[model samples]
Structure formats: C-alpha cells, structure tokens
Target chain A: MILIRVHKECKRFISKCLKHNINLITIKSDKDDLIVKIHDNDLEEIVRLNYYSQIEIIKYYGIKGVLLNLRKYFFDYIMLLIFLIALYFISNIIIKIDINHENTALKERVNGLLIEKGIEVFTYRKDITDLNEISNAIVEENKDFLDWMSINRVGMKYVVSFEERIINDISEESGNCHIVAKKDGVITKIVADHGVTLVEKGDYVREGDIIISGEITLNEEVKDTTCASGEVLGETWYKVNITVPFAYQDKKYSDKSRYNFYLNGNYFYKKNYDHYDEEVIFKLDIFGNNFKIVKQKEYELSDLQYTKEEARKIALEESSKRLLEKIGQNSTVLEQKVLKETVNNSTIEMEIFIVVEENIGTTRMFEVGEEIDTE
Target chain B: MLDIIKSYISNEKFYIIIMDSAIYIKNYSKIINIADDEIIIEISGTLYKIKGSSFSLTKSINRELEIKGYVESVDKL
Candidate 1:
C-alpha cells in the first residue's frame, strides 16, 4: 500500500488512471491523498511516473504492519524451507527390538514362532499394535515353552518378554515314580515320601539300584503302584584324566567389544574372520543370554587356536570348574595321578588323572493311567 | 609563432609558451612537485603524498588531487 497526493487539487493523475481503467483491489482516501493497496505487478509504472512526489505523501501505517509486509517473503519462503530441514534430522529413523529370554534357542525359536504369526524379520515395519498381537500369538501357541509373556513399545523399539517355564520334577502327584542310584556307591542316607526302599543306610548298591520303589501291596492285594521318590545321598566315585600341551599359545587380544547394528538382518564389523590364532575359548551364559569374552571368547571358535602355559593354567582352572559341575556342587577329591609331564618352547604340558567322591541319584516316575480315589 | 603563443597564454597563469627556438612556462616553470620550507610532496603512486607544510598546498589542488592508497586494503575491505 502506498500513499499519494497531488500538489494541485487537479485530477490529472486520477483522471488518467480512470481513463486507463486500471483495476485496484483496495483504495481509500484521506484528507488530501489517495491510499491505494495494489499488487506489485500493476503498481510498477504508477510509482515510476512520479505523479505523487510533487505533493506531501505521508505514511500513517504503524511499524507492526510495516514489519509484517517485510516478513511476507522471508517467512513464507526461506524460513519454511529451513524448518522442514530441521524436522527431517529430528525424526526417528531406526527401529530396535528387545528380546527377553534366558535361552537363545528359545528366543530364536520364539522369533521364528512370531514369523509364523506373520511377523516378518525387518521387512514389514510394525508398531506396538502388531507387537501386542505377536505377544498374544506366542502366549497361545507356545504354552508349553513359556511361563508368561509381555510386549512393549519403547519409543521406536518393540520389546518382547518370554518367561521360562520351570518344570519341577518333584511333586505330590509324582507318587508313581521311583528313585534309583545313578552311580555304584554305598547309601549314606535316605529320605522317602512314598513307595518301598530297596536299599538301607550303609547298604552297598550298584548303579541302577532302586532306592525307593513305586509298587505297593498289603495283605496280598494290589493296593497302589506309586513312584518311589526320595533323596538318597550315596558315596559315588569317579576317575577323570586331563591333558594339556606344554608348548601352547593363547590369544592375548581378548578385547572383543562387538558392536552390532542390524538393518534388514545384515551385520557389519571389523574383526578378522580369516585369521587363525592361539586362544582359549569358553562360554558364559547369563540368565539365557550368551556373552563371549576373554578366556570364554576363544572356546567353540571356527578358527584354529592355541594357548601357552599361562593360559593353560587358566584353562586347567576352567576344566576344574567343568569337572566340578559334572560331579555336582563341592565334592571330595580322593586321589590324583600325574600320568605324564612334559615341557616345550615356553609351554608346560601335563596329563593328570583324578578321583572324586560324589553323590549321584536320578528319580524316575511312572505315570498311572487310573486315578486314585481318596475316601 | 610568438604572437600566436602569447595570445593563447593571456588568460592562464601557467601555460605552454613556444618562443623563437624553445618552449617556456608562461608565468612560471612547470612545477613537478609542490614543496615548502616545512613540507615535501612526493608523487610515488597514482597520487601525491603531501607531507608536513605541503598539505595546505596539496589541499588547494582539491579537484586535481588523487589519494592513491591501496583500494583493496581499505575500501574493498
């Protein structure tokens, strides 16, 4: 909008404009001038002619309105472009999934199980709504595998929890079962709940001895065939022999911090997959998740590896741990034999045989097809 | 030639005058520089650096005085 006035009260300019039949969308008049708001294209020639400079053309518009006119081009074009670019960077671009399970096999099984329910792997993008349905499907189909389940959506990630099904072998309904000695040993003690015991305290029994019987009889009549169930701590013996190479080389670089990101089931990393080296390997399972590191990282590797005397010592310690696991808890070591000993090229090798005393028992239950009536 | 040269030098204080055999300054010799007892004028660049007392003399030559300082160092910067 521009304000214009003529020096003389003549209508020379106005008359010419009227004769030319110019179209102005908005026009107003004040004490001595005409205020015309016209589009930029049409007002070019009018301003060029200088028809109003001879007279005083005062602007009465406020500063706010003047600034608004100046910002029309800047805000409508430049600022809008800048705002859209900022929005693109702040938006979420990746989707993450959190799997909660103690067993990798079961977790993978559940993932495969979810695929059966139409949940594709990194292909079809799904949100919490699909997550909820997948959870429901897992709960319905894997009743025997999972104890409980839950699905959650945290930001752009989908988390699923599959609680493990803990099956306790001992219960009141397991009366149709029998406990047998898993190793040849002398029974040190016995605790029974049902069925007849075939061995007594200080009684020597071999492997497969029925410590508690599942059959029952009274007055020459068939009464009950229940599981013989009880804990019978027996004095079991074992001989274990282990050998280690004297000259062995173990991997010194165990700082394997595998940072993995998956996009469409693809992996990227810098670890050399082709190099063969000396290393000791072991696996540690926390809850149901497996982490590979240090001495545990070298175990079960698809590459050739060896360990020196120091790592061999650690490997011996790990082997002792495995032996303890097989023997159950803390057991007494009766005798040890060093079958062979050798040393080579910064390596110490020895073959040692050991004897251990332990308690081994296994409970077997026979399920009855008929129900017992309690009167 | 002298009559013609004297007629052309009448209205100017400094003019080119051609005499019988040599050229001469009409009222004074061609002043290559303007100097005074307290100042010196050096025309080393496109313009003259009027130092000390010669500033007033150089100032008098306003329309003809050109300050030839480096344009890129000041104006363009």
Candidate 2:
C-alpha cells in the first residue's frame, strides 16, 4: 500500500499502472491525498525501468503536487477526560436563601403561609420570584398589628423596617386614671386635653398634688370621667452618682492571626495556621436603606503599654455613657470626683464618682384591678 | 550508553568518562558553564572549551541555553 498527498487524479495513476502490466488492485482518493496498492514485484520493475511516470499522467490530469505521508503515533485521549470533569463540578454549585428572624412563632406561621403558596424555606434555588412577595404576604395576614415590623435579607445582611400602629382612644365615661405630680416642684407648664387641670404655669404643686383631674364635675355633680393623659413639665430636682475605674489590666488579642470561613452562620478554620504579623481585621456593621453591610478595616495591633491616665479617662467616659442611656438626654452633670485609686502590679484601678440632675418621672395606673396586657 | 557522561575524582585530577570517551582536568579545575551548544571549564590557570548541541544549561534567573549545529571539542594548547 502507498499513501501520497496529491492534488487529485488517482484513476490516471491506476490506469497507467495497468498499462504497464502492473496490477493496481486498490485505489482511494481523498481531498488532499491518494492511496494505491500494487504488487511489490511490479513496484521494483517500475522503479528499475523508470516507469514511475504515472505521476506525469496525474500531472496531465491537472494534479498539482504530491508528497509521501508516514503515520505513526500513540493516543492518550487526555483532553476528552478533562472536559467531562469540568461539566460535573459546574452543575452542583448553586445559591441558597436562608431567613433569620427574631420571632420564632411568627416565623413558623409565615413559613407555613408561604409554603401553602409554593414558597418554602427549603425550596429549590430555581423557585424564588422575589423576597417582596413574602413581605407582602405577612402584611396581608396581620391586620390588627399596631406596630407591625419586618426585617429581610437583601444580599448578605438583614434590613429592618416597621410601621407604627396608632391605638384608638376610649370614651371618657367611667372614672379614668389621673396622673399626678410625684415630686414637690413648681409647675412650669401644663397641657390638659382630655382631663381638667387644677394647676397652671408657675403654680406651686406639692408632692402627691393633682395637676390634672380625671373627673369633670359640674354643680358638684359627676358629669364625666376621662383619662388625665398629659404632660406636666415641672422644675424637678435630682441627685445622681456614678463610679469609674482609674486603671485596668486589659487582655487583648496579640499579633497572632487566624483565618476563618463562615457558612450558615457557623465559623470554621484550621487549627494549625496561627502565627501572623501585627495586622488584625476589624469589621464594623453599618446600616443602609436597603440592607446592612460590614465595613472591614485592617488594624495594626501593638502591645498595650501601661498608662494609668488613659485608663482613668476611658473608664470615666464609659460610665458616663452608661448613665446617660438610662437617664433622660437633657440631664446635665453637676459634679464629678475621683473618689478612690488602687494600684496593683500591672493595673492602677481608680473610681470616679459623679452627680447629676435629670428628669426621671413616668406614670402607671394606680388602679387595683385594671392592668394593660403587653406582648 | 555512549551519550552518558559520568564524572569522578582521581588522585590529583578530575576525570569524566563516557562510552569510548574520556576527559581529565587538574584537581583545582571545575566546570563553570555547560550548555547544549557548548561546555566551558577553568583548569589549572587555563580555560578549556567544547562546542556542541549537547545538553541543557540553566543560568541564574531561570534562563536555558541550548547548543545547536556541529560540536567542536577543544583542550588547552
């Protein structure tokens, strides 16, 4: 068998071989090559007699060029193996949605409602339309909610929004609760809308005095009774005390580093990779109109040096912040003093005492049986 | 087997032995650069060179040198 790349015209070569008394048993022609088979005895004579001019017959038939082809190689089939593996991995990675809400009972109710409408917590990734459908379903279900609120996840964080419900006012027929001044002070002002006020601006009201009355009397006969629900702005005096530490032995994370990954709210990390330089990643959560996102910053955490003055200042500021959150915002500091200081090995502990005057008066019903239920 | 070049140290000279081929150098000599196209060495206050497309030599910073064409062997004259 002979294989050669030629421009065409294999039949002319076979016909010429037959004319030379050579048995051209087989002939095959392709786009760029031709193959012919003959007896080796005829091939030897054809070369000796220089009768290989069958190529001239090909040339006469417009065959352009001819060349021999030697095919010998192995097969590994490696590229086809990699293509199948890539297709297997890509088909499994998908997105999943998880809802984390505070009210477990309400969440179960909502989950059941959504599942009835073909939206379940464990539903497949392809079934979700949008999260708004779930939120709208909740609002449609709870019509009596006075302060209905919802928090949803936008991408990776939760966004909370709420609507305040106003409670309807009851008519004033039976005797309602009357709010009175609890301290001895001069009434700066009074707002009496549903009830009758017995005192006005600049009126000196003693402790347990009735600034507004719940009963409306005419000609010494009971006409109606209403709730004395109004503010009595008074010049009230108070005394507050706070304590602080002058120094502290703080335990902080060293320059040791640990890399962690979290999935489904669980943290996972390798136990071996520990030694790192001075950088620590700090993440702070910030709220936006759509969702909440974490802002991460890399901080170089240095070893804490002993500083008594800085510790004292930090303690005082911390105590003041805690006090203000409990008291009203209008409260002003009247006095402050470092009452005590105790220095230990690595910590110089101190206490800061403070006093302030703030408004701290709120009213509750004093009835024996009527109590408002809260959930 | 003829392509394999093995190196060893003699009493006072370094010897390279291959199939039907041998080379010798003084004890103070060492192979400084060997490339696919050439082999260079410093021997006893003299320089010896051999040129051929023989083997691969890697330079610092990960560069390869390949010798091509005819091989010409030389010794210190």
Candidate 3:
C-alpha cells in the first residue's frame, strides 16, 4: 500500500474543490491530512494556485516496474538458477563408499574391484543398480578369499559388507603320520589310537622323540602303515620375571574445561595449553565447507608413591599376567608358585614358576618308500 | 478510424469494486464528503456513499483510489 504525505489543510481544500466539480479526482481524508489521486494537468493547476497545502510522493508500485527491475538484474537470477540445478545434480551422486571389514588390505581390494565394475564414489545412484550382479561377480572372482558379499545404498553413501573364506588344514585328512613330542617334558597321560604307544605315563621324553608309531606288524612281517593319532598330556614349566616401580608419574585432570570452534581453518577462540586433551565434539564437511567443534580438558602430571604392600601386589599381578601370556590358549595351568622376590630401594623384582598340562604331540609325515630307521 | 481513436482515448467509464472490508474505484472524479464512519466518492458523474466504522483511505493513484475498513453498506447517490 502506498501513502502520500501532504499538508494538514489538504483534505479541506480538496473537498471544497470536489464540490465545485473542478475535476479534483479521488480525495480521501484522515483527520486533517488528505490522500489525493489526480491527473498531471490537475496536479499542475493545484500547484500553480499556490495553496497552503504541500504534497510529496511516498510509494509507487506496478507490474511494469517489477519486470523492468528483473530485466536489469538478469545475471543474478541466472546464477541463482544455475546454483539450484547444480545442488540437485550433486545430491543424487554417491559421496562416500564405506566397506565394513577389519582387514585394510581386503577392504582396499574390494573397493578396487567395485571401482573396476563401474561402481565407486561420486557415481550416480540411479545409474548403479544390479548391485546383486556386481556382488556375485566379485565373489566369483575372489572365491578363495570372499565367502559372501553384499552392497547397500544409504543416503548418498554405499555400504559394502563381506566375509572372508576360512580354509581348514588338509594334513588331518591324510592319516599317514606319526605323533612326535613338540617340547621336552614328562608324560603325565597318554591315549593312543591306530598306532603303537611309544611313551608311557611318568616317562621322561625329549623334543623330536616319537610318542606313537604308525607301523603295524603281523607274524613278524610288515602288515600296514596308518597315521598315528593320540593325545599325549605333559607337564611343562615356565619362569616369568617382572619388575614393579614404587614411584610413578600419573596424569591428573582439572574440573574446568573450554570449548573451541573452527570454520574453514580459522579458529573461533585462540587459546593454547601445554598439557590438554582435545575431544572432537562434531565435524561437518558440506560442499567443501568445513566446520569443527572441540572440547579441551587441561591436565597435570604428579609423582605418586607406592607402599610396600602396593608394590608387592603390583609385582605379583604383573608376573601372573606375563606367565599367562606365555601359556598357549588351549593349555591348562596345573600349578603356580612365586619362587623368589627381592625388594630394592625403589623397585621390586620377582620370579614366578608356572606348570601347565598341554598337548605335546605333533604329526610327522613319512614317505611310503622310505626305510624305517629305528636305530 | 479517427472516430474510433477518439472514442478509445475519451473512454472514462468508472469502475467500483467492493470486496471484504475494502473498496476500489477506477476513474474516480472526486470526494464529496468524508467522515469517521462514512465516505462519499464521485466517479464518472455519479456519487458513491460508503458507510462503515473506522473508514480509512489506504492508497491513491491517477484515477484510482483504495478504501479499507469494516464496510457496513455501499449506496449509490
């Protein structure tokens, strides 16, 4: 709505002129001010009369004026139109490809394979159907490594998942072998099948000694040869050495923290600390614009003193942890004892002896035409 | 052809549009009287009296004017 500012007596003058039929045109009043619509000739005549009222143009509007302005700034409108088109085109393409696998090499291989099949980052989603065919082809090409594969599209990103094939050992299938001791130990128990037991309980055995023989004899003549399979349990000992320090430096954090933000490599607040832990709150990258928020927590390091009991407990725990790591996963711990412990001014040293019952027999394949050298 | 041109140029027929709470007039000639509750407008050679509460003139251009308020009645005078 447009409004014209005029003198206070403008309404009275216009109304008097209208009554005289002086072609005064449209005239309306608010208290003392008047709104008048007159032709150019009539307005000129009014001004010539030198009336006490004044007039001023306040606002104007028409379709022709709007179209003229749009024509004048045509390039800006064109740029806006192009920007919208580009946004629509970019949103439909894949921005990232995430392969869910623990092995980096396998993930890279799968990604390379997908790219070779015309599927990768920045590829249009509409152009990349037939994912099942692609996955089948990949699995077929990598049958020895990939057991199953699948691809899924999620919000401009392609998520790929696959499982690796696990190959079993083939030596167990061929039973033409003998059981030999893998480590020197005392035999605690033995159970033999399809072979002759060469070691008995409480018998001292050495590494590379045959525990079970695969040869079978009948009437003092060679009958047949089969793989010797048995479980020979033996008691193995290990000595674990560990040292614990009485004084150490530990990190202590303050209750206060500060937040910082960055946009396109420019920091919002510039404050640096010597000892602080930074945690990323959020990071965003859209159309090459980067933004990040980080929280920094300040901390200090202080010396901590340990008592005799604390040092001894730490030493024992460390020794036991070291011994457990040395023992294999399938072995059972039979007994454990701390053989010796020595305490110094600032350190404590200890030796732990561990005895475990484990399978000591390993298969040794023999050639069929080889002479039996049982010396 | 000259007569047609003269007729087209001299065409001064008035048009009045009464919408909800607003009145628009084209080819308006004058304003006869204006009050807080009523307003009288001259268009072509006839007078139109608009009665309402809190009447206001919102806009004015060449031969055109717009009135806005609670319009109760419109009568030709």
Candidate 4:
C-alpha cells in the first residue's frame, strides 16, 4: 500500500478508478486535494490517469508489497518438507528380527512363521495388540511343533522367544521277537536279557541274520521258544568320494570404502572399480520416495595354490563330514583310510572308507508269516 | 418468482451489517463515490449511501469490504 495525495479532481479520478474496477482504499480529504491509500497493483494504470496532476505517493507500507520475497526461499521450504516426511516414515519401520533358538531348522521355521504373520524386517511395525493377536494365532496354527511363542518389540527390532514341544517315547513290549542284523557289520559288543545269545563279540554278520535267537536251547537241542531282546553295537563301513579344486579364489576386504546415496532405485555414483561389493547401510521412505545409503568396498582377488598333501587333508575332512551326515550324529568315527586317489591337472579326487560304531539290531517276529531261517 | 430471479443472478444477495465501529458490505456492485463523511455504493440497482465520520477501509477484496468508522445513518438514494 502507498499513501498518495491527488492534487486536482480527486473525486473524478476515484470514480474513474472505480469504473475501471479498481478500488481506492482509506480515502481522506485534505485541505485542497485528497490523500488516498492504493495498492501497488493499480499504481501503473492510475499513474496514466492525468498528466496535469498533483498525485504523489508519500508513504510506503509493509514487506508484503513485493511478492518476490516469498518466492526466493521456495526450494528451502521443499527440502524441509521432505525431511519431515522422512522422519515420520522412518520412525515406523522394522529394522531387525532376532529369534532366540539354538537349532538352525527351528530358527528357520520360526522366521518363516513370523514372515507369514506379517512381522518381517523392513515392514511397518505392528501395534502391541495386533502383535499379540498374531502371536496367539501362530501358536494355535502350529500346535505340534510349538508349545509357546511371544513377540516383543524393542526399538526397531522384534525379538521372538519360543519353546518347542517335548514328545514322550512309549516303547512297545518285545514278544516272540529276535534281534537280527540290520546291516552287514562285525559285532563289537552285545547285551542280551532273554533267550540265548547266538553270536559273540567280533563275530561278522550279514543282513537278515539273527544275532539273538528267539529260542531257548541246551546242548544243541531246542528246548523252548521265547521272546529275545538285546542291543547289538557293530562296526559299520561307509565309502565317500570327494573332489576338490587345486586353486581357490579368496576375497579379502580392504579398509577403503565409499558411502553412496540412492533415491528411488537409481544410485548416485558410477562404478569406480571393476570388482566391489555393495551393502545397504540404511534406508528411509519419504512420502513415495525411497532413499538408501549403501557402502561399496573394493576387494582384490587372489588365487591360492594347494599341494597334493593339502588336497588330501581337505578330502579327508570332507569325506568324514559326508559320512557323518549319512549316519546319525551319536555314532563315533572309528577309523578312516584312503582307498583310492586320482589327481587331475587342476583338481584332486579321493575315495575314502570310514568305519563307525553304531546300533545294528532290528527286531523280527517269529510266527507272523515271516520266514525264520533259524537252521 | 424469487427462484426465477436467483437463477439469472447466480443467487447472490446484497447483505450489509452495521456494527459499533465497522460496517461489512457483501454483494455490492461498485463504489460510486467515497469521502471522509459519506460513502456511496450501488446495490440492487439502487444507490445506498452510508454517512459516517473518519471512514477508512480496514479490509477489502473483490466483492467484500469492511469500513471502520462511526456510522451515523444509512439512506437509499
């Protein structure tokens, strides 16, 4: 606004301004002319009203008279708006999930269950009541595998605690049954409680051969038939073939790394090195925009050559591990020997034989349509 | 009959209210004249003149304005 003094014919000028749809605000009659306050918007055309004039602007008003002052800080305000939006969404994101279980398969099962319940990392955090509802539903769905489960949120992490179901064993009574050899092995020990012991320690037995007969005999004659029960520990053999490369590539990380930012799906940097690893450090969502910070570390590839002796050692370890996976974990490894070895230009292959002490007894009934060759 | 006139005129009615020290006028056509003691405006094809003392516009837009002063009388001219 500007306060102006119109020298002559002020009413005619005001009427002319109103005729042209321009408003004259705050008018006051002076001794000779009229002093008026007019906005800067109508100043241009009102200046051309008359040349014989005494219209002069005396006073200027506030900073809002020029609208360009607000337009200069437009980018700054937009940046501030984006920052506030990011803070809002980032505070509601789930970052980590910790399952308190020592077993790997059980941990994987619980993790899968959590994902099915919509409680996964990088998703929005659920309310406490909703999380409790989901946990109860999961426990109800998997009643056999899980006995109890609870989910609690601490900061950005969801800690899941659970206990597995404990099953009881009910052994059936052995009646008219004989302990036979399940596999071809040499007997290491035997403990018979009933019937008669047909084989002693260090006795080599084949499959389908009964180690404890279901008959009571004296002086090489059958007196009676009774149910036999016993445990037979035997030395079992396993053959494993392993192949390993003579040259192996190893990746060792260096201390040099670069932190780069990403918006939406486009990264902000070019590939500086030919070989490097990228890891996501942090991420945020601002409205519909995605922001991520990634760390890129450059590494050098080096090939380490292995000798025949070193390859043999590695093959032995691998063969033992494979044999253990095939058998149960309770069996003990007795002995291992290299049966054959083949060496190629860049690889080493070995065939190894492993001996283990394990239970080799399987029960067989006497008169239940089974052919019992006790002769 | 009122609906017939409102349909052509867009249903805009001229309304004015007098307060202690301010006068609010809505839907007036244009300003005919303005002075320290009198303000004349056109509303409904008739001139409405407001006699006041030390009249100054407190707020204004395209079709609305608030005049701050001591209002003495309002007459249809």
Best by lDDT: 4
For candidate 2, the C-alpha RMSD (Å) to the true structure equals 25.9
Q: All models, DockQ values? A: 0.01, 0.01, 0.12, 0.15
**Which regions in candidate 4 have their CA more than 4 angstroms from the true location?**
A1-73, A96-108, A112-119, A124-235, A250-255, A260-267, A283-292, A328-332, A357-375, B1-77
**Residue A374 lDDT (model 1):** 15
What residue runs in model 2 are displaced by over 4 Å at the alpha carbon? A1-7, A10-175, A181-211, A216-224, A232-312, A327-375, B1-77
**Candidate whose TM-score is highest:** 4
Q: iRMS of every model, one decimal?
A: 27.4, 27.8, 5.9, 3.8
lDDT of 3 by residue, A40-84 (tens): 445555655526767764433366446666887789989989999
- The TM-score, computed over Cα atoms with residue i paired to residue i, of candidate 1 is 0.44
lDDT of 4 by residue, A30-56 (tens): 787878888887777788865456689
**C-alpha DockQ for predicted model 1:** 0.01
State which docking tier applies to candidate 4. incorrect
List of clashing residue pairs for candidate 4: none
Q: Write the per-residue lDDT of candidate 2 for residues A309-337, one digit (tens) a residue.
A: 77666656666666667666676555556
Please give the distance, in angstroms, between residue A114's alpha carbon in candidate 1 and its true position after superposition: 7.7
Q: lDDT (0-100) at residue A209 of candidate 2?
A: 71
lDDT of the structure predicted as candidate 1: 0.51
lDDT, residue A146, model 1? 79
Error of 3 at A363 (Å): 3.8
Model 3 Cα shift for residue A211 (angstroms)? 4.7
